[model samples]
Target chain A: MAPPKRSVPDSSANGGALSLPRQAGDQRRDPSDRAIAEACGRGEAWAMELIYHRYRRRVYGLASRIAGPEDADEVAQEAFVRILRGLPKFRGDAQLGTWIYRLAVNAALTHVTRRPRHTEGDEVLDNIPAAQTSARDPGLSARLERALVALPAGYRAVLVLHDIEGLSHEECATILECRVGTSKSQLHKARARMRELLGPALAAERKGE
Target chain B: MRCPQLQRLSSRFLDGDLGAERASAARGHLRDCERCQRAVAAEAEIVAAARSLPSSPEPAQGWDVLWGRVSARVAEEERADAARSAASLWWRENRSRLTLAVSAGAAFAFVLWGAPALPALGPGPLGLVPGSSSGGDQAVTEGGPERDGVGESLAERGARERAETDRQFREAVSELEVIIAEEQAFSDGARADAAGAELGAIRERVRGAKAARVALPDTAGRPSPRQDPVYEAYWEELATLQRAAVGVSDGEPGAGFRQDPAGRAPATGPVTGDDRGGDGPQGPGGARDSAGDGEGTR
Candidate 1:
């Protein structure tokens, strides 16, 4: 019995539109992120899981890039936990999807910071949950994941949001709670770190290609 | 442009964040600098490869089953919320009485922490007589502890120590209750686990719960010998064990470990069985102290 209403979402604050869950069927066209968020606030079960379904991959993607696959599912769960707990009181100042992205990024960053010695390889890969392969170049993808995990949490979050998730610097700053200039600086440093980590892997992938 | 200058704009160029003029200049420089070109190309590849990695879907086997976990968790959260609401309602209904009680409590706290500082309010400043200035020492010593053979100062000191122990005991018991409740919950979860890695995680959690219980000082129903954080943690663990039991079973839950129905635990589970109890919680205090000590070591 959530009262759905029309409220314009301010995309400029969060940089752009993210794929938020829309109402299904005949109700799809009119349901904005704000409407779905409002419905969620009103205690609609569909709205809650819809939030989960829509952001699952994006959340998993951000977490996998930053926290590695072994820890990504946990991070994603923590993110949803926060979102479910926080969505009830959500005031629509920003896009709902942006808020979710911010939660996921922050969760991923905290997980990375908590476990600094997260070793990579076959054993760690064994614990990773079910992942479907969309990767055209699995060799390059593996190398990039390794390199990404090597960056600092702050820098990794920014790089994931901007470079991997294809968010703008403004968007990265919005999610990371830093200035645009800081996001750009961190992105610069993260790229350098990636180059250092991926040098041999990059060459190997290229040679294999 | 110098390589350093071009390098600074590298992210901007990759993100297309630079102004059109600066982007044009960076492109011209990139045409001459092979190193910068390679850097740009690598950045692009990283982004593209990252995007292409398979999305980690919700595990089909785990999703339907874990959804049960989620529902259980959500229901637990709702129960907590309901409890909070009940507390809130109690506060609202009893606000006037609560205000009076709180005012009295503040006065009581003032009497505890402030009494020593105020000459007019509490224990003597070691100099003053209640009435006469000239006969101060005589009057101060007058009518003090003529029968008990213990001075009023010593009696007061003993009373303070007893109160402190009583307070510590309450804290320790509250903490132990939480721990026990959580242990029961963990056991229920372990029983429900399917084999493979999930079972491994449940076993790890069980080990962790055991480690938490090990933090207890083997005081074993001995009335909290000291107010230690370790004791507090174990008490909380017990309380959690109880809550977990209530969630899992209807027949004889936390009664398995904690013998006290009133929950007054200077208590223990049998030394051999982590989840079973005999006379441990109700046994002679000193005997359980020795027995609980042995179990604590394991």
Candidate 2:
């Protein structure tokens, strides 16, 4: 058989060589959030693209953490669409990134909460890395992950933002809409509990070694 | 900073929130006390472990899928906007033309309705006989020589009437001037009366001052003339009063004539050629003749 040729459209061929460096430089010189927001307010395509590029990763990360991998993609896209619609009313006191992260987290949380109980899939420990998983420990990582998932949504959110995400206490508090004192206390309690849950397994592993 | 306080400060301290003095106190306590130091260390370790947890992986499908959705939405919005703008531009361009067409149609209808009604209202300038029309046309044709006999007669009559009117107007003006002059005299008399009254009061005051001066014996004591400020002030006031009285009297006559107290100028004896006849004389005897003429004219 002859080698299959890659099909390319004429328009795409013509447009493929266009670079964004000059456009990016122009935008960088006038990197006004207000201008981007105003354009987004008018529903401009390029403005929406800029907004998505700026915040999509953080939004997707937050959504994946809250809703798990299955629904994370839908949750993140929905969050961006909501952000675009709400851009006109976005008061500028908080950083745009922080606002976007909060929206994504809320949307993911809401989605997960509204899902049917039976829809939660089997607890699987197969994906655990070899370094984290031992032959002797049947499902230690799985149990820890279960304990973390079992934490109340509020505590889980704060813990993830403060601990797993490595955000500052103030940043966690801003995203969770809680006081800094509450964030610190909640983080301390969550870690102590996680340690308590994991302590026996970890100790058993050491003893066996 | 031990126990409960230490517990509170432990959280703040770990979060880097303790005030300087309190933090220093906590630091000192932690250094000395092993129990609190261990607690702090344990908290730090836990926080570190929590922070060390790996973040969730990125979604398997890349941004290409999201970009596709966004591009579709953007294209739809752009098309809608373009359609709106095109419609608006079309309306703006054609609005004046539409208004002009409507206005012309309305004006033509109005003229069609109005044209027949024009003749029924009354005869216009074109309908009347030239010499036999009413007073308006007669007035207009008065100077034409086609009606030369009538025109010459009318001209003679108008000139005679105008001369008569001029004579009457002159007579009226002369009578008014005489009335004005008499009024001025009356006002002057009234002002003189008021001045006399003021003069009497001043004389009485002067007489009292003289009496006081006379009663003081010259031999008793005499203050230096320059030191008598009261006497000097009184003398100056008297001089001021006299000057004011003279000014008041002078201004009164002109104001009275301008005000015209009788309200109308008097008529004269048939207004003879002499302009001064209307004035009669500059005395009270002329008042009778002037007053009679006023009554007769009315």
Candidate 3:
């Protein structure tokens, strides 16, 4: 039988990083991810629905940013299929969230590699206004979004996971199935590439300063 | 370090990945080089812009619609898995029956492919009727003076081939009768009883086929041999009996069937009518008795 449900703090609500283990005292009663995963493994439809609801946001986010918004739906759906199908065999070696994130990231990366990169359809990224951009230089966000699209899928994946999703380098490493050092290097190169792409915007920002 | 070299280390330095010495050198260069300082600041801003990008873009078709797709895919996968499991279960239940069918098919194919070669190997016991002359040779001789060994008319060749096949089948049936009789001698179980009943049914059908074949008028001088329903039924019954007899001899249900009542290997030769009273199973009987009853009734 599944371990009895106990009160575990809901760190996701608190904007905690994706790897939410049972933590110090706070009251929010919900089933542990392992309990949910074990239930899903038993071919319980309700348990699968619960898992889909729980991780859908993070998975969709990974898909949109890494694969771009146009293909996010297809990519996220593929990831969920893999997750639910593999649930029965989901040995709890990794945290459920971490494992799901890995599957989602892998799905996104695979999608990008299999299809030609297209920067034109990502209207979501195009619409994002840089938080620090001056009113006079509104195109910075658009340029930044294009720069992300221009990077290779591997580099883009690191940036999306580590910078945008707020996953640590270790988590990025786990998801990408790369070394932590490799993750860091990819992030560095990704950011440098972004800077190179956004050179004109940066020059304007420096002038304004 | 020069400004260009310091700029190269800026990405690592921004992420705090530089070693202590390199980081200090980068810091020293950045303190004096304004261009390098602007480059690092720009790198930081790009990371900030990326972090500010919304994690989940509201899908153009909405969350509910996307969820619907996912839900359908999951159900499709579940159906596929269920189908696979069901197929596996069916295979497990019927493995022995399927093996019998496949083995029978392969054996029939082997027989069809190798049939023409049998006449070259000469005749065995059941190759001719007890009191009759060679029927196939007689048919060929009556057919014409227009024939060479290879130049025989198609009709004559088919008739001859058909007779050879029938003779070979009778010889095999005679051999199977001996094995089954010996098998029944040392075995008195339900399996042996079942085998006897099945063989009896086959003998009854064979008798019917023989009667039907005799009733048909020979329009082409000899039998057409184009379509023989008896051979089809004969093949099926032969295959079934062969499986049962082999099972008995293989020690599956009847270990005693492997040896005769005297603990000797049973005779492997075809049992003729006269020989049945001697080496065949003695006293109260099963398949052999039923076989005799079938022959007597005919």
Candidate 4:
């Protein structure tokens, strides 16, 4: 079917990830990941479009979580540029997706360092919004979101990559360029920090109030 | 493990990071301690809540806007890369020729402009004459002609005049040596030997001056033969040597030149007796004959 044009729908009005509307068997016709990477290295536009579509949600999500939603677009754009440029040197030692995550996380951390902000660790406990007591933990999601923003960059990265994104500590270490032991330690610390940030809310949830 | 230590492993337990032994130990601690159990539960809730947090709400403008931005940036970078590649290719192709051309140009410029200034500077600081630098500087600054508001510099004109003077001085010295050779009146015994020794030393200095003149680039300015200070000093010694060869004394006119009160010593520092003593064997004829031969060859 005309090789399913490398075009995105005008999804500007939509507030969600793009849905692939192409028919089945499209995967069979598509190039393998290595071939796509090779094409990207050759500066092929279609290959870049394919890679962007494949990883946009994950890259943007990682960037938004690590570098705040406001700076996500810029960080994600930079990450994609690095990914495409660095593909020529991609020796396939790691999965392309893992490699891409490594690049995105690096971009996000760089963005965070470039623009300093107040993290939860710096906030006084009295300043934390008291959790509403509810059996079903009614604003738990919303409260946790705010708390995530308050966490330090290091804690936030570990929490986001491990807890939120559901990556194994080994994968987290790979993406974060830390040892597995360090990743585990960071995750433990990150969870504790999250509990502290969500103190009243988590306490309420545990109590089933 | 104690409650406090096991409490630390609560996050690890939830993530299944604890080894079997630690996990079993942590479980045993959790079962017995209510506060620790509550902490572990809270940690679990926090992780679960985070995982439930919506996958970054798709950017409001969706992915198309990002694609547009990214693609535009990529295209710009590609153009820049192409331009750089072309420049690199050009440089690689022409690097050898470019290097050769630059080196040749530098060498030609040095020969044309730099070499001409060397003659005017004399022997520099290392010269035997203590005042050589100041003397050379004085000659350049004082002997320079008036510019007359033209393309030519005063220094260039001075250089040209000096070159002409040098050529004339060489010719005159050659004529003097020939005359001295014809006036063969070698003194007898010890006196002739002593004069011969001193003349040999003076001849060495003359030879050194002659070499300096030959080494000058063609563009170097020559001085007037009579006013050539370096040759003039050598001429004084030659006159002394000739007086000895003609058996003339300090009071007499020898080779049509009057002896200085200092007895034929050069006014400027030239070769001294200590420098010339016992350097080579010579009689008065040896000195005069060599001088005549030097002039003939010149």
Candidate 5:
């Protein structure tokens, strides 16, 4: 059997209290993110907690786009484990959030490929509030999620990193291990296909706005 | 203006990546090209929708669970690395002793099966008996006697025959002395015949040393030129005469004599100097005769 997926915690419950202590330096600091990376590298407990709290939502969102809502939690957890193991070797050449997001995308893809028939309903989409579903058009978010899931793993990874996460083409290239030209090409293709999938809803939303 | 070129630029343009010239050309082409313009708008909407999609809600499990899994993996990898390092250290420490044991085993095998066969040395042909010497009475007794007792009696007979053997040995010695005296007179004639051979060899050696010394180009000091061959030959002759006088002085009576048998009386005879006449010390005429005939070749 494939290894069990990791279970990442909900970031909303811990709020911003789980962030790392601020360092007095000239650099623009994400004290929480920096603390998590250093703690994970040193195998410290609080650092790991901060890392999980900081990246859990972003990692799960990436995993959900790639693998679906069902396996996203496990994929997110495994991505954190991988990050912890790779932390010492991480040279901080890229943003920690970008690196962790890439790891989450890869973990989700691996989970999907290993069990291709597994569906999104296998695991509940944890921490999705019932009120937000009615207040916002939860159906649009669901439709967008389904459209992304319908795309190929490579296309989905590019779309999620370049579009939803707002990563630049170069940053997407670093995560995908491709040239910027390739990243842009993949992003264009992924967006074109996604529009084809959600054409009616996008048209309706545009008309309503 | 071309459809294929327009379509290719459409992808880059939607991504906002078409360079200024290409983007302007693409926009100009799309303005005139309705079919291409529709495709460009559709691509733009897709990129916009993808960018605006809502992020997923966070998972229910919190940081504690995720941290636990990460810590476990890190710990496992560290343990594996430590084990590998320990194994490598063990190998490094034991390698020298292992090599020494292998070398010793190889040497032992060489001695056991790879050694060359040795030649046998028993009491047979070419066998050597320890302590055997000439003129010793115990020589025959020391070597094992034949089982028939014939070897024992033969050894006794050999011992009794020694007295008669002593008389014959003295006569042989006297005859050898006479022959030696005649040979000496012949040698004297040959010495006179070949008047300057010894002196010539000496002169050649001196000339060789002088030339070698000159060829070396003395770094210490300049050397005098070598003497002419005639002058060198004269000095060599004088040296030969001096050597002969020394030889005569060393060869006094009883200087070359060996011991005779105990019971033998002293034997005397006339000294025959007749064989030395043709090359006598009288003049150079006899020397020329000896040289022409090659009679006293030295």
Candidate 6:
């Protein structure tokens, strides 16, 4: 979908990010993500900052989940660098969000494989999503995080993309560079593994059912 | 398809690739097969459970560090790209001039490298013929072709050819004069006066041949018909050689000129020095001396 129609205030006209909020229907038209990307391609500081503002938490959060805390910062740095480099060629066939998510996924995966860090101390606790489990038992959320981390990269990636990220199998296949059949198979296997890991936590919920 | 094949294709079915008939067949099989139904439920449960996983927040310093590094990298790439485009523009503008310079340089190099061997490659003028200078004692080559082939122009070759003809006629006439002088020295008789008169005629032919100059090939190598003494030189040389031969054939040494009609060739191919009587058929300056002896008798 095309980006929301808000005017891209000229950084030079209002000194970029520090500029005041515009009133409704200011005559100036917003630059789409494609334009923002083109501006970033020109190495505009404001455009780069805009990209950071737009997807900072998601990209950083993705890096932390896939690569753990030790390499999260490195992974985020690498992803944004790649994203900026790739922006000029970013044909808007896929949502910019999907494209950024893929870059973050690849960056996190590459960082994990290169370093091979398997420490489960702080990362398992920190990898939990923010809003969904505030009302759930903290122990079960902790258990799910541990189970997710222990899964192999192929299975983990499929689960993360198709289930947790709410993407269809076709989108998972595109990001992971595999056939949709492979994505479906991996997702099934990942879920089966999750069932085994959360058997006790699930059994407690099943007893009430 | 069998149960196993259907199970394998189950993912594609869920992803909506299955045809209506196959989907209905699989749906019928699922209704009957308890094992397949349970697998489908399990797949749904796993998807729900995974969706329930929370999205954890990243570190606070992450975006700041990422932006810093990404901006630096983009800046560096832009600088490199700018340099590349500038170079591309320069090449696009100057391409034809560069190609022309390269072609001209190559041609110049080839000419310089090949210049030394040019004389051996040229179709040289008349002096190059084997017996062209048979009249003179010397080799008779005036300005010979140099390595550059600019050694002699067609005009110079013409001049050299004329000089050769003049020298030959002079030598033959000189031989006739010498033979006549010898006859006068030997005789206080009447025949001696006739030899003196013939000597004067031979001397006149020598004078005529000397005055005539020939034109040779023009720069384009075509022989120009513009008759600036070239025709006169040939005419005078031929007349001098014939007259000297006639005078010497009648002198005391006449037998040399009687060798053979074919051997009596004159001027351009005059007697090759021994023009005295009976020296040899191809004797130079020899055939005409014999004319001096016969002329003395007359």
* Residues B157-232 of candidate 1: C-alpha lDDT, one tens digit per residue: 3234334433443443344334444443555534222212222343344456446434532212222212322233
Every model's TM-score: 0.49, 0.42, 0.50, 0.52, 0.45, 0.43
- Candidate 5 lDDT, tens digit per residue, A41-98? 6666556656666666677688777777777667776676666665554556656655
True contacts kept of each: 0.20, 0.20, 0.39, 0.37, 0.36, 0.31
- lDDT string for model 5 (B10-83, tens) is 66676566788888888789879887776666566555555557666566665566556656765775675454
DockQ for every model comes to: 0.16, 0.07, 0.15, 0.14, 0.13, 0.11
Error of 5 at B130 (Å): 84
Task: State the RMSD for candidate 1.
Answer: 18.4
Residue-wise C-alpha lDDT for candidate 2, range B34-90, written one tens digit per residue = 867756765564455554445555667677687576556546644654543222222
Q: Between 1 and 5, whose TM-score is larger?
A: 1
Give candidate 3's TM-score.
0.50
Candidate 3 structure quality by residue, lDDT tens digits, B67-120? 788878878866754643222222222322322332333333233223333453
Q: lDDT of each model, Cα atoms only?
A: 0.48, 0.46, 0.55, 0.55, 0.47, 0.49
Q: Can you give the lDDT of residue B109 in candidate 4?
A: 29
On DockQ, who's better, 1 or 4? 1
Per-residue lDDT of B156-261 in model 6, one digit per residue for the tens? 4444544554454455446555655665676562444554565576566555535542222222232222222333333333333333333333223322222111
Instruction: Go through the candidates in order and give the C-alpha RMSD of each one to the true structure.
Output: 18.4, 44.7, 26.2, 33.6, 46.9, 39.6
Mark the regions of model 2 whose C-alpha exceeds 4 Å error after superposition. A1-30, A117-147, A205-209, B1-13, B18-46, B53-56, B69-298
Error at B79, model 3, angstroms: 0.5
- Of models 3 and 6, which has the larger TM-score? 3
DockQ of 5: 0.13
When 2 and 6 are scored with DockQ, the better candidate is 6
Q: What are the per-residue Cα lDDT tens digits for candidate 3 across A1-209?
A: 11112211132433222233444662223556666667677776666766776777788887887777778889898888778766665566766677777777766765675575465323433443444447334456556766667666777787777777777777777766677887777777777777766766577665665
